[model samples]
Target: MADRKFALGTFNAGIAPFPGIVIDDTVYDARQVVPHLTVATLLADWEASLPALTAAAARPVGGGISLSGLRVLPPVTPPGQLFAAGANYRQHVIQMAVAHKLGAEGADPEQLAAAAAAEIDERKKHGEPYVWSGIPSSISGAYDDVILPGGWDDHDWELELGVVIGRRARHVPVADALDYVAGYTICNDLTTRSLVPRKDIPMMGTDWMRAKNFPTFFPTGPFLVPATFVPDPLNLRIQLRLNGETMQDSNTGDMIFGPAELISYISRFAELRPGDMVITGSPPGNGSHWGRYLQPGDVMECEIDGLGVQRTRCIAEAD
Candidate 1:
């Protein structure tokens, strides 16, 4: 068998969507060879399932399905305990703070980013990552349409690197945290910027639950590239374009806390189980910084190096 890298994705195969081993454009059903194989089962025993998946994926199997005709679903269906990071990127944190407090009235995106850069330079060297839980139902497919919730016009795009856990972890040390990672995928952490702050209760601060977890808020994965394929997750390029205009262009290196650090930090208080997804915070170039927000008929093209692309369209929710 020729050496080729394979990723796992969920696709509609008749009655329901099932996990399939994806190698390039062709998707092969491993269930034909390994009975009752699902994404949950594979992740439940990632170590053992990986080799089997690799072998099955590479085989010149009978009647392999074409990925084009199939409706791709979120990589991990009923996605495991989702934990998302906030203000984790150096520039993103700066941009978010500037827009939220000072407003982007006259500031150019570059000026705002620079001002944020200047102030965020004094960030704590030993700060902990900010993480919050999300429901699996909020997840949508990579190519899915995003319905902007009614009456909220400030929907924004936050292209983030998603980390999938392969092991049950608790109090995991930063140095050894990457070992618990199963694979990596792209996640668009959609948020409603206008709803972020709480005026009714100033002390309560951000309202992440209302701002972040709307339906189809998290567009995750065209594929789940195994950790082995991604030799250096920190160096990958992250980019997003709105209506063919480049919006966010940054690298994972700008993250104040890398995937390992974020995972390890979150695990200190929460037990991260297999299939759980950790959204490593987004980089700069959000709508808030640019003073633009999502509008109906807009197209968001999101991509991360080697992880494939997600092209999602936006539509206004009906009243």
Candidate 2:
């Protein structure tokens, strides 16, 4: 209904979080249009709320708040379930393989890259995505501070395109998977690389709970841009900067498993509900590759096309 696109976010004006819509640069409290609408409720009935949200965006603002200096919460607090795709980016997987010596040391970079690309193609043809679940408590707002866990020295950043599920999805086909997506957002899948593979449980392998589920480990959302606005999820640019230095930069096209395939694959085993998030894997250029880990007082700014930017400050956890 509004002339421009719409995005959803939660803002605190000193009290509880309230649903707000971002049009241009200002945030209009959506309660002025629909008093009962919250981020969770909007996702639960996303399609039904669009009309009212659009109308609300066009209405006159009597006391709309400026976004500057305001506290912005995660668009969807305590999302239904958070699913993260691992090793889903072609270049990132190649980088990891080479870094971990999965490929021969003497092999040429071009040859290795070719081999990696071939491997990814084969996997997409016959393999399924690697999906891992994260605790809801790990989520924090896009602008919130990230706490570096005590005794951990390998904290890393993995900027990703976060897909928000709008409808209940089970056994969805790849062709129709995007239909279930409510919108898209930005998510920083922060990791404690040292705690990933457990030595105590060698056979069990990765311990995501300990490595990825710390409080504020997942910093997400400046706003949730509707799916319709994002014409092609695979063509977006994804980048992250650490204290003004660009650390991770790549395109969504590098993904081994695109958003549609990922949604379809995950739905086979788990029912994706509204407000649930599927974080498409991050691109190449992680701290491990650069030999630089996150430090206290470091700021991370991540952005994707259409989706708003997320600026997060890192701090050390209290001992």
Candidate 3:
């Protein structure tokens, strides 16, 4: 068996990459590092470029950004808007159902009932499928802090496998969807459950972006592992640790919808561009269950099979 290929943050000690593109405190031009290529383009060009990407992996290039010098940015620059699904996993949906039944204390009973009724109506209208959160501010590099904004006492971490679109896909068939993937990386869809004032805010309507997409809400990878390396995306393990203690541990197999299906399902309405990202749902272990929340100086680590680990520390914004 041959070795696999991966991309790293190559940066300089005195220079930075670019605005919004941060690596280990130093920034670099993403346009230069990430070839203006999509997943489909890479696959088509694989036969020829494979050797070069492989050679780089085998031999270290001098004067290049060392892993220590460059911080791992989210593998791809976020798209204009990002869409995420809610209760997409059967187990997660069931858990939320129970939590909703417990009811939110201090909320008006009649209003809560009305909200529940509305949710039932929407369920009849759309079945189990729902999408929400056009998160623009949530775009941040993988190593960036998963900020715990004040007032968010129920901050949580979700271990997810993120997929990057490599082509312009709209209404693509599931059978051909995998062809549009550029690669896969590890993502921590950090969220704050306290933002939803009432249980009535349907999972989709909770502005999950506010909880999930803080400035550095979505911390992603060390680097992207080309799709070719992931023969079975569903088989990968997804694990997360808080302050060096294992908090969540599960496999991608637990996802309600596989990557190919998610890509195809999302493409039906919106066009998935070369750099757009979709975070497949997370596994069971999250901070909420342990009654823990992110505090200043907290550290989080997320790792997925094939893709290496991404480590980040939570810090307050510079005054």
Candidate 4:
């Protein structure tokens, strides 16, 4: 019982349990504790330390801090580094191209009307690629609030399936790439649409870091379901909601660039270490499509088939 693979975290009532390294009653953050173990020293080792982790975790943690009373922290506090794919979905790419074209020319009344009609017609066709960078310092654990940054009047939610690396993969072959994955987790790549314009080239251009990377921008976790649990990461279902209203609804099968290809491509440039996370892009149904965006006090929820659902609320920036 002390040397077996087990998922840790406070599981009771409404509190979302983050899969972590449970050492007695004190659950050291999973990402933090993994570094203490040298083998693989990355997400791929999510299962390698089973024997030692189970034994250490079984030891009774002194003090009266029961599991239920603990507030879950981000599973992997520092993921070496974080990067995200943009417009990886076939449908999302098409939508982005149309948006960019419409935004390019539509200043006049005649142009605005034509652009509107073109946009509607384009919706029937596929879109193109659009990229943006996410803020890594703003990452948070599941069940945490995503505080919308100041100057951002319209925030948005993007439901994405995050990939956790399992080993030191550098230019690994796509066929064997999936083997390097440790597991999967849910990530809400919250964005400020009004701030991150899809325009081509403006006088000042665009800065996605400020628009997408605010504190708590990447709300992740609930659990890192082992890869064994997800034989085919591309077949799972993904869904998102705002205050219970379904926003993003789709499946991994819709991804144009699959996980293996993405991992291999990224590793070509950087030596992806343990705990490094890659948000594999989001599906359609973003607030930008609608006239409104995330308002303070709105609750956002993201769910994947194997990975447990992640729920967070929006808050105003502090004065």
Task: Give per-residue lDDT, candidate 4, residue 15.
Answer: 51
Q: Could you tell me which residue pairs clash in candidate 1?
A: none
- What would the per-residue lDDT of candidate 2 be over residues 139-228, giving only the tens digit for each residue? 999989999988979999999999999999999999999999989999999999989999998999989998999999999999999887
Q: Whose lDDT is greatest here?
A: 2
Give Cα-based local distance difference scores for all models: 0.87, 0.89, 0.63, 0.68
TM-score for candidate 1, please give it.
0.92
lDDT tens readout by residue for model 1, 1-319: 4457988888896778788888889888767655544786678888888877777766747677899979999998758989998888887787676666543578776777677766556553645777888888899999999989988789999999999999999999999999999999999999998788999999999889899999999999998999989999999999999999999999998988889988888988999999999998899899888989999999999999999999999999888
Predicted structure 2, TM vs. truth: 0.95
Off by over 4 Å in 1: 1-3, 97-124
Candidate 3 lDDT, 1-319, residue by residue in tens: 5653455332223554321122333233333333534333343344444455555444434333435655444555434346665555544544454445535665564555555555545663465446555465676666666666775467778777877666678999879999887677777777778774446656554555445666778776656666777899989977888899998787887666677877888888888776566778877666766668788888988888778788888876554
Question: Of the pair 1 and 2, which is ahead by lDDT?
Answer: 2
Candidate 4: pairs in clash: 42-274, 44-166, 93-127, 93-128, 94-126, 94-127, 94-128
Best by TM-score: 2
lDDT of 2 at 157: 96
- Models 1 onward score TM values of 0.92, 0.95, 0.75, 0.75
